[model samples]
Target: MNRPTLLVSALWLALAATAHAETAADASADANAEANELERIQVTATRSERAIGDVPNTVDVIDRERMETLLVRDLKDLFRYEPGISVGSSFGRFGLGDIRVRGLGGNRVRIQTDGIPVSDAFSIGSFSNANRNFVDLDTLKRVEVVRGPTSSLYGSDALGGVVSFITKDPSDYLEEGKDAYFGFKIGYDSSWDGLFGGATAAFGGERWSGLVAVSHRQGQETENQGEVGGTGSARTQPNPQDLDGRSVLAKLVLETSENQRFKLTVEGNEDDTDTDMLTSRGRQALTGAINDSVIARDHQSRARVSFGHEMDAIDAGFADRLDWQVYRQDSQTTQYTREIRSGLAPPTLRDMREREFDFDQRAYGLQANFGKDFSTGSAQHALSYGLDVSRTETRQKRDGLRTFLVTGATTPVMSPDVFPVRDFPISKTTTAALYVQDEISFADGAFRLIPAVRVDRYELKPQADNIFTEDNPGVALSDISETSVSPKLGAVWHFNEDWSLFGGYSRGFRSPPYNDVNIGFTNAAFGYTAIANPDLKPETSDGLEAGLRFSSAAAYASLSAYYNRYDDFIESMRFIGFNDDGLMVYQSQNIAEAKIYGLEWKAGLELGALSDKWNGWSLRGAAAWSRGEGRGPEEVEVSPGVVEERQVTRNLDTVDPLTATLGIAYDRENWGAELAGRFVGRKDRVSDSSLYQQAGYGVLDLYAHWAFAPGATVNMGVFNLADRKYSEAGDVPLVNGTSTLLDRYTSPGRNFAVSLSVNW
Candidate 1:
């Protein structure tokens, strides 16, 4: 069947099931009691505690229980069933890159852990890449995803959406009348021959509590379903690799009074990987050297220390509740590559090249939030206000050397770049923001109106030292200072107890990134030079969304439609033209406008409501469809010396195709199982005509959990049950022509994962 027909059929089937259940029995009142109880509170949507159904926008929460049941090993697994959101990958070297919401990725989406921003992703050329995969899933208590623009509350870097990760506290583990708790878990995955384990301990006293958690993991290369195995670009199999990672999380809490508390937390994570790059083992036409062997070692680490305070029900003149935190974080990524090549100047001589790239960022941040509840006549109000201030310093450097194997002579020069160079200067970025939001209710709680606004100031300062100046001679550095304002308004009308309609208008903006504003590099061998552009403008988005929701004891369903328009979108590394020196000039510029529209729907039904024979059975499904187009500047030559830049509209390649997921589950008191299917449509809407369009495919997955003992349980999952070969659209690169390496991008086939956990 076609995409539209399949989607319609699924929706019709769900509605039919719900109607049948409603007519079959009178037990609908108690059908989904457990589900209602499990999903109660969320904080990311409004920056305050509120029920998911009460929020005006689309919000999804994945708690610890869900993560465990799904056997989430990484970001990809975490979002496997979530529509309209995906994790981008960097082939097999850098693993996962960033989370894409709607049609935007990279720095457009904001990610935070415990209210602190995570490090940004940076990439230069082919060998150096620093991604935003710093969080360890083992330490998280829950993850919240808010779709659409939320800059009014989060300030910059929220043009698309926000992902908030909340970690576990000591109180979560301490039971009533118990002062201590301990837990441990171990897991294995066949896709990568991976093994992982973790342990957690918590202690509580009269007024003090403490907790410590540690986790470690080791794995081999992730396997693909490729059949060809050989050296050079023809090799479709995965390279040989070894991966190791570990993390530590510790927290201490002090309760001073009935309504006051303080907390101290420390977190650290480290990851290392070694790979034998067999794909690069062929003749290189660019340098005219035969590659014999290539190897790479990558290291990534992050550390953080934070202190926070919280107080409630003070009823002070300024606020009724106050919370604040101060934190310092450091993150770094270092990569080293070694290659041995022959067929150089003389066939008898060989050369060995070694390269190292380092990127680091250190940040200090302070945030304070206050909440107040009051009433004026018939209107009720809940006010939330906050301030955020942060300063970050970023640095990057690349060094390399080539040595002759026989003569042992060393040279500090590579083909495209020289040794000991800096891509952009040592820069510091500072931001300060203040925001206010009010939730007002009228008509006896039937109608709610939310209005919010935020003002932000951003500054970037570049320190050009000897290294940067020597690399790019006669280049002038520049500074950037800008201010932005974001606003949002939303309303919800609950005409009845089980039905509601919600709509919202939100504005978002993102300041120019430091690297994009001041990127300076020279590649004499490639006949191109990248120069800095200080006058680049910030990117902005305006979104409008409306939805209808229905909730009942037996079933729940929601459908939302959204349209977002973006202006002044920044396009990095765009080639303008050849300069006076006959070299191509590349620069980052704001020369694009785009609009994206989509529809998202989710539904669930409890089969037990129909009759006792169908007890312990349920059905759930979700789907999303989006289309986008962008208008960008295109150069046209009218005459010999006359050129014009005209706007040309084309389909956006970043937008994913229609996708849907459906699952049927059965549950008991101590054990449960689920069978799910995921469907993806063909990708034919792309800006580049030469790009390969992937065909539609569907895959099946099975998951189960059983509690063998009181404090022990085992979770298992089997993915791609049919062993079908497929690849995600985003994971596939933009190959300009028919390529033989397409099989390398295929995902793993028929993988199984099993994990065991025990608590005491």
Candidate 2:
């Protein structure tokens, strides 16, 4: 049978069995009752404690239970079922990728941990990847995603949205009435072809608390069954990878007095990956009739330290709570590559090359906030104000060497001169911001309003190295400073107990990072030179959103739509002008205006409410659709003077295809199982310069959890149950300047994973 037919058949069989299977009715009823006692979920995405529904914005929360149930091993695994989001593997699974939201991605999104930014956004030679995957999932308590502009809370890098990961504390580990706890878990994954394990210990006391966690993982190459480049005749080989990592977390909390507390947190991670480059994308040295080998070793490390204090004992009448924090984060990535090529005729090594690239970044910041709550006649008000200051520094270096093996002798291929492949000098950026937000409720909490504003000042300075400056004597270093204000206004009306309406308008901005402002390179082989522009302006966004939510004991649903406009879009622009090297030059410039709009919806239903027979079953689903276009400068020579015109509507590359997820879950007192289907629609809309398009595909996953014994449990997941081979939207990009897809980078197909965990 065909793939689709088999999928339908399997689904039918599973549904039939679930519907007719004999189960303990009384047991199922009790399970339904237990599930109905849902706890209120609070989120810190808004920089304040608020229930999920109270926030006048689109927010999604994934708790520890869901993470385990879904067998989440990494960022990609966690976001598989999330709508309007796509994680791109531009480089490879190890590094060089980004996460997209709505129709924007890359540096537009801000990723944080415990309200502090994590990794630095830096890419050169397309080697930079989103540094989000280094964190161990076993240490995370929950993750929250706030969709859309959030500059009113976070200063910059909030143009698309914010993804915040909160780690576990002593309280999360200690059971009720318990002062100390110890837990450990070990698991394996078929896709990764590896084993993983972690352990945690926590102690809680009246005045002091402490927790420590350690995790380690090692795995082989990820599996992929799809054809090379989505074609039958594969010209390039596929590369296999070796991966391993370790993570450590430590936190301490001290209560100095009643209503006053202080916390110190330290987290660190180290990951190393080895890849066979001959079969990797864009690294194949021999197309046919020859044997070649290329190996790449990538090492990444991250560490962060934070100290914070929270106090509510202030006697000042205008303030009820105050909090302040200081943090420092450091991230580094280094890659070493070696390649050897041999001719089929003699099967002897003929050429060899070695290359290395290093990128490092550090950030230090301080933040403080104050909150006040009061009530007037018939009205309630809550106000929060905060200030943030941070300084960031980055450095990049690259070196390469090539040799030819002839007659059992090695000969150098280049002149004896110092050359840097990626020669970006040290760059620094300092940012300062102050923001305030106020929430007001009227008509006995029936109607609410939120108004917020933030002002930010940014300074960018470039420190050129002697090696770079000496090579190009005419090159000049410059500094830039910019300031902007972001504002947000929102309103919500609770018409009844189970239904509410909300709408909001917000503004966001993204200041150009050091790389964008001072990036410099000259490639004589490519006949091009690219230089950064100090005059480049920051990217700004204006978004308007409206939605309605319905909530009850048996069902919950939400529908939202958003429209966003972006100005001063940053993009690479080429000018056919002669430089000192007499080569065409490319410059980073702000040359476009764009618009994006999308719709999102989520719903869940408890079948038990309909009848006693269906009490243990529930249905949950989510869907998202987005579209965007951009306008760029187009100049035309007229009869007299030149005329500038905007080009026709051009599709944006960041927009993901229409996607949806549907699932059915059955729960018992000690065990539960879920079956889910994720569908991705065809994406024929290609950007102006894009040469590839992604076909539609669907995947069905089965997950089950069982506590067979006291303090012990097992979890199982069957991903891509149909074994349908496919590729992620942005994973398989078309060959640059051509319509043919590349010969690598396809999503894995048909994998099974099982994990065992014991807690005490």
Candidate 3:
């Protein structure tokens, strides 16, 4: 075993041994304290407020305190130490893409902020990409991540899991005796040469309260460990870029009575980027021309307005508590590219191309949830129900112009692509869902049975205007209407005060996306055409998970195993056959079956509970192992002029290899420090042999925090302490052959980040 792996194993053994050595009396006291703490840490990703330990699933919560201590600036940083979870990013161009849970990512994972879903991610070709990085970390109070399928409670996109970001409220900053509060924070990161600052103010009166928070950030391109510099594909260094971002969050709350409250929130986020694509220089495979300059300017923005109501202790015959919200959100992304090419067909001729791509979405939604507690003949029950309704309009456009510098003439027609084309028609999708869940308790809550179900209706309408028809003549569009029913059953048995056994079976499904159903494009120069497929079926999964957990004030541990089976998986842009025009045809289809299974274990220990001499010392460790495979269709040649398709089974490349993390920390009243290490196994279970296989690597990180004065604190961290040159599997693309540009995808070297916060 490697050094990091050995260290993690030793830490887990030490924690288990220490807990075993504790006296019975001490164990009982610690268990009680742990129970109380768990009860206070509530998670809302389940569609209901429940203690983390009470939920029969793998759930992780990152509160503001943890975010501050870790100095998390992006999604990649947020999930650095988390096993079975990772963020995908494109060579610093699109920045962070989306969060992947287990082996699923992209639109399969549901991402929301304050109960409103974020915009979908879309990409076409190499010049256009729209990502789902709309939320600002500085405005969030807490983040909840639910692993595995959870569609029974969250609806369509929860085929993988759910990520919920809850924003801060005025009450959070207002103390009992304080009527008004103000806070400020600043931070810097060496990885991107980034600087950020934010300010927050809250005012509270007898029945009225208000809050406003604003933040701004500026940064350069993210650094990598690449040594080679200059231009062309041979260079490994990061391309030059500038990034600017801003965010604003404002809220107003009114308490009508002790049992009722109302709130209004307005939030906006904007980001701009400019990149010099030095890598694109000296590349001209299509035109055989030397590229002089290639530049890209992109902007992404999102705005949301919501109104919500909360009521408690309502004696109305049906229930006792209620929560509802109505919201509207708009998101847009624009990418523009300007390129100049010299040494064309004529030695003295030069060409210039300007391309623009836009993707926009506007959504209106309403959600209502109710909770009731009642007793049956021999069991107590906690009943929860909710309804969700949402309508979203999605639109996309691509426009470009190619100009001959000598002639001063421009044309919208490029050989491979034409200007002013819509990849898909303007479409509107509406979804309505209703879910109900009940928890039955017996033997004084020692044993509980929970069952839940959700019914969803989805409808899509496409409006193919001139922009769409003009590009793809004689194309037929199809409307989609479908309904899905998902159900789940879970049980939790508290065998003892300090130990529990929990397990559950859940069903998840994802509706066919609009773009996939109505996609249309033609590349005559490439001798290929991509058409829409309206007969696609939704993807479904059956997941089973079980785990044993032990918790105490002094130590905690858990071991979990899960198996998931998926059917009718969607594969986009798969080659089908040749059309009547002798052009290659591609279409999206549901043609895959997959099975994934994994084991996860975590443990933590506090030395203060063992001896006074070891006070303020703690150890924590976690590890995960997973394997997956899928059966899909692959084209094969039967004879010289005949081709056929066959079902093939291969390892799923999305699943990461064995990974583990270990951390040791020392804490005092005013200061604390932690040293953490991460270990990853080699990635070799891939279907494509030509893909780059990353080797096993180990990295260490150090973090520290100090509160030198009242209401003032400083946090700092150094990541990749060994300056190792490594690459995450997700960041590396499949290369056709032995490529010399592999170093370009390596992760950053040693870097530091620091932040300061003050309140008055």
Candidate 4:
């Protein structure tokens, strides 16, 4: 990073503060009274408490109460009822259940928790799991989904949209003046023959308050439902896989004064998965049996501490306010795969890919913002300046073995000696960023504007070559430095009680995966073996969006559109060897251009003519459409001459076309019933020339809950009711036949689950 260049950018931004002295805000609804303005408490789309109808963008809010009744176990489960969102073909079984917002799908979007960026270090996560899984829905207060890129406000990877889950505060755990409370729950599922339990407690007194929660769940997979003459079923093996997991979460706060406070949060999460999977596709023989292995054994722990003095004076100047936070994390996971096939050439097949990893990351950040009431100035404005520095270091050691089909040639063509072995030196990356944001309001309250800028410097280093064993030498590597300056500009107008408009544009970019930063490969089975090329560049994008809002306490609607233009995109090219282990490997390359465009819509309604007892019933929905194309060197014409003729696909075709959901719920007295359905669009998502596409499908899920008492409740739900037939998105064409298919996973049939809870 060039220090002089960065300083110049910061100076220019600082001067703009004096020129554009307009009051800025996230949204007006956040500052309003939640109890009085039930219409404005939206967590998604925008930050402030603006009604969905009054904002120009698309946002879908899943209130905390709804989650209690739904009994969701994973993040994908949360999208089943949200508008303009759909579960991708991966079926949410793994994190691969890509989420499509406003036509943009997969990792193009961003995921956050309580305002902090979530991890996406894996091979470009769209709907795939990460170092740690998403937080449980039960622990969340509300979910906010903004349907387009706002990378200017944030930095890096904010392409399609951003989804943030906000957790509840200490106040939510207390009962009036009570100092402590407790709750317990247990659940059972038929599909997985699962068992679940949870407990929570809260305490508050004098200047301190805290809440603690713990939970566990165990599950067994359902038996196969398909009847390929029970030939392909391979029922002779283990019919059910098992999983066990536990988690602990806590939040503590100390209040020193009315305007000063301190808060701390800690969480430990871990899960063990024993899964039985099959390699049955369209052309593969049913003779190949299903595989069994300990799919995942993951554990993670994290802690965050922050202190703030709301309104304080610093030395001789009125410093407005100050806040500082520090964070740390430790996590590990070991994944293994084994074949339990029946009639293959090699009756017994076993392959194990093991990774023992340890990483530590820390952040030190500070923020100071001045309050603006206009009483002392002609224009009311608040300005915030902050500095953030982070450092993360990780060590990785992976061991793997893949089994191949042995023809009548008994020589064992690809033996272990020359087969595949992967080991990479420990890699580390560090970053330092500085930023400033300001908001100004004019004409007392009619107009609001926000302008912000951030500058970041990153350093990447790879350990020097060393001997791992007596005769083996580690590979040599290089270090890299990256710098970027991002900016945003936005404005909003309150035309009247029923009309308003908003427009904004943000720039975002993503550094390539750390693993790909330095390494290349020659012999790799499931992972890149070793072909280190430290010259790859980061992908950048400039995105813009416009929206409209209209609202009433009882009803509201929103419509929005956005476009993201990308540059120097990192892509994968087919420059490789044969797949001795069934899976294909590609040499990653860089592309010059690509663009994604989308539209989003969402609305809500509260009934007025119905009985007062049913006044809580509401109707809400959202839908989105997106399309993208490649325009650089990667887009050159090609011919495969087979089942596939010619088509267009940008990098991974995981992008879904259109996803939508419409549902109505009745929150009557103590009983609630919700009928929700989710849809997934089809796409030829393969990065290969064949461009195999999966047809789109939808599934209906029904849930009901009853509050038996102040501290007790029951929830029952049916998943995939009506036994829909579908697969999560992975698919490819047959060897010689055009219409024939291969290797696609089908979602499970209808299943029921019930849970009971008690609290005090």
Candidate 5:
């Protein structure tokens, strides 16, 4: 485990309660659950507690009540339901996850924790959390996913959209007359022989309230066994990660008066990973793939502090919020020697360390909103305005070494042997940004308009001397500075209380990484080449979104469509011949243009009667389609020495064709049950140098619960019931190399877990 792992020992206790079976739970507890189903659904799309229906944009919300019984642990488990969204894991661990929104990648899909941006800044996988193996999935309230281009509120990365991880706020769900809430849970997984346990406590009063949670888990190996139940799966990705993780979240709320109060909170994330992979020497025998075993260790830590205040006025209010944070991350990789039957080469050892590498971000921003409702020229207007600013600095190190492996099992299922190699020069970076927004509602809220803009100035400083020297130069010396402007416009017309129509236009972008701009190093940064293009430009998008929503107290439904125009897309181009260090490296270059378009539809309704017995049962469903393509592009590099401005390859506008979900849920005072199924179609997505056209797939999940004792009960279910075979993944295509040797599993197979919980 890395050094940061110990810090997690002190944290909030949020357990992913699990049970293998799908059946009715305890009785009176079910009665207690009935009240929860009827409560209001509050979302932070506009930084306020407003009914989801009131928001004009398309927002996917998974409530806390569902979060509890469903046992959704990581990003993948939580987001697979939305067609407009796709998720991936890093090293097959829960500590890390990648998200793609509206066919846009992670960096463009701004991720926030409690409305604050919280991802790795190294620009490697475009996420700071990359080195940390598993992301802690504990007591979370709900995840709010804004589908489509969201350049208005969030800045750069909001090009694709935004996903805010909102953890449970202690005072909202506590029992009446009780000072606090306490819960404990224990569970297990079949894939990795993994075991996990956690606990949580929350306290509240008329004026003050707070919550804290903690959780931990240990695992040996997890099976990959591709697409189970089809032919034969018992597959494996890498067992290199001997993993342990912990997280803590704390918050305080103070009520100053009836009209206002204050809120302060803190969050921490840490992971300790010791990875040692297990693979087949000659797996397929047909394709003659090569497999290799290995070991590695890494660590990560992130901390954040936030404060918010609100004051009431005559039918209006003034709200102010401030958020700040500091984060540090490190990664190291080592190769060991081969033992017996691995007569491919004599066992060798190499050391690779990424030191002097620190991801630091010092950001303190303020957002002040002055909102009011007044009659003006026979119309009522609710106007709000605010400002936002933040700065981030990131650095990378090549202090890592490589070595061969020994004492580990040979590559699995008859795979090829191993060969040793080395590369030089690591990459590093830093950035800063500032912005503002204004929203307006006219004619008694019949029509609402919002316009916002953000200006960002980035400084890309690359320390070439650290990895490369003036004598053995690849990158030599290069530093870059650039500025960007993003704007948003939207309007919603409430035809009536039960219906509304909305249209939105937004622009978003991302600056090229320092490594991608000035690294003369070989590929191998994250096992892929670290290409640099000094002239690389920022990626930009301009999109138009239109939608309609028909909602009532008992039913809700929505339909929306979007079209995106992209400019100067940043792509990691294909690699060329061996460099001075005899290593292959791909180039990070910018493209002219790309286009994306999509549609989404969703509906919900109450069912099973509204009276006694089956009173709270409801049915819900949603569907979406998206496509991405390179437009008016140029340049083609043929083998040898031929370069021509070719139109491009794989510019098909048919990626992520369709995604849909159907669910049945029972919400009661104490007893509840839910069953949801999903189907996603094939994707034909592409970029500058490659395209990934994959077959679509589907899965079904079952969850149900009942209350037996006063404070104890059981919840159970199955995920991917049909044992579906599918990949919600995309990557730059590979060459003639045996993937079995260097590749990692991208998706999880049919798996199940069970747990019991006690709360009083």
Candidate 6:
């Protein structure tokens, strides 16, 4: 069917299925029940416990049931059917990618697990961890996403949005009256030729509880269905990743009193990947470098330990609750490569070359929050205040060794390396922040207003590790400091029990990262040298959002719009022949101003509410459209020894295409199934660059779940049901502003997966 026809048919099916399922009175009762259940779902969107529906913001929650039903294998799987968020995996690699929200990504968004942040942001060459893949999906019970600037409460790194993963606790597994429980799960994915298995055990007593979980996975490389250039071509995208991963989680909880508790959690995860990097199609197409053999072994791991305490009753005046947590985390990624090349006429390397690189970030943090409830005349108020402090130390190292031999020479000699690979130095950053927020309800709960503010201080100290440059000159890395203040205001008007209108305005900020500020590099091959930029300013954003929401026994829907403005955007500028050094100079500077706006709509219907005969049937859909434009730095040589830097206004390359997802589902006690379609609109407004323009496409998927007996279930999914070869919008490889190989980064072809799980 056509796009419009398909959408109309979907609506008709939803109404018809529900119309014959139940009577009006039955539907009303069902609506009430659903509303009640929704009210019980609590969230931390405002830094305090509140019902999901009561929060004056746009948020998405993926609970454990949904996670298990979908048989999620990675973080990207969680957002496959949701709008406003897109997950993109790096080309030629298995796991490294990014999660973009509302045209912003990378360091603009913040990721957290149980209120503890992960690693710092740093990307070099083809290797990156921008997706926050360090967390173990097996141990997670839920994932929450809040879109838009939240720096008023989260301090920083929340310019685009926030993603929080809630892990499984002992209380989640134990029965109402039972004190202990254990379970295991096994899954397989044909696309990656993967196998995964996990087990969990938990127990709780009168005053103490504990839980432990372990999971492991092994997978071969992922396959692509398209040729190198998307047409009849002999070359195709290379697939050479072989991966193994393991994760462990342990927690302990003690109830000091009826109104107090203490908890400790320790979690660790590791991933090892073996791949042929230099021989990949993208690499070969980039520089015409043919490879005899190129092998890369990369490892990534993360470990975190956190201690927390909570009390409902505190002695502080008017304070009804107190919460505190202290945590220490270590995240690291290391890569070792061995390659040999000889096919080229002038070979870069005819023998073996071995290289090692390491990037590590260690963090320690402390957070405390207190909540109070009171009344002021005709308004009831809930106030929350908190203090946060954190210190992070980042270190990087690299060493390259090569062995070469002439065609007639028998012995290969180790040669001295001339060019340096990694130029970033060890850096330490300390951040301290204080924040406060208050939720006030007036007009007898008909109107609610939330006001919040946060102030932060950041100190950056480089280790003076870049004392000697590639030119054998001594240079000093300066220390930098910055301060930022963010504020937010939101209000919700409840016209009646079934409908509400809400809006919010907030400010966000992002400090310059160590890699960007203290970058030191000299590429002789490219005739360029990059020095540190200690005068960079922090980026800031101001956003306004408004939305309307309505819910009934049989259906629920929301419509929202937002506009955001950013200033002092950091961008890299390259200037040639502007100085006496006689080499091109590159530096990061605050050089841009931008504005972005978008509209979003989501709706869901329950067929069971229409008639008893159509019980367990439902329909749901979501759509988002966003566009942004900003001024970026560009350098042009006006005359000899004279170059001018200009700020050009253009569409941002990070903005994703308009996207939507529609699904029909049937869920019951014994069996469940769903059919979904994802659609993308063409992206042409971006700059006339090969990397930004993308075409529109659509794909279908099917999923099913069956419960054979108590606690025994089987889930299966068929993705890309029609085997259509289409690429996701904005998913492309960046080959350093060169190379025209854009079609090598498409999504995987048709794939199937099945999972068997049991709980007791």
Task: Give me the candidate number with maximum lDDT.
Answer: 1
lDDT of model 2 at position 344: 35
- Cα lDDT computed for each candidate against the true fold: 0.88, 0.76, 0.86, 0.56, 0.57, 0.77
TM-score of each: 0.96, 0.88, 0.96, 0.77, 0.76, 0.90
Name the lDDT value of residue 57 in candidate 6: 77
| Tens-digit per-residue lDDT, 658-743, candidate 2 | 88899999987789999999999887676744556667889999999999998788999999998887877757654553533343
- Residues 177-261, candidate 6, lDDT per residue (tens digit)? 9999988999999878999999999999999999999999999877667465321123356456788999999999998888999
All candidates: CA RMSD (Å): 2.3, 6.0, 2.6, 9.8, 10.3, 4.3
Per-residue lDDT tens digits of candidate 4, residues 97-119? 35566545545567766656544
Q: Summarize candidate 3's per-residue lDDT along 325-371 as a digit string, tens digits.
A: 99999999999999898988675468898999999999999999998
lDDT-sorted candidate list, best first: 1, 3, 6, 2, 5, 4
Q: Compared with the true structure, what per-residue lDDT tens digits does model 5 show for residues 625-725?
A: 66666754555687668877666645543245667788888766667777899876655443423334455667788787777788777777677777664
* Stretches > 4 Å off in candidate 1: 1-39, 347-349, 523-528, 577-583, 636-644
Pick the winner on lDDT between candidates 5 and 6: 6
On TM-score, the stronger of 2 and 4 is 2
lDDT minimum window of 10 residues, candidate 4: 18-27
**Candidate 3, which segments miss by more than 4 Å at Cα?**
1-15, 21-40, 347-349, 523-527, 637-643
Write down the TM-score for model 3: 0.96
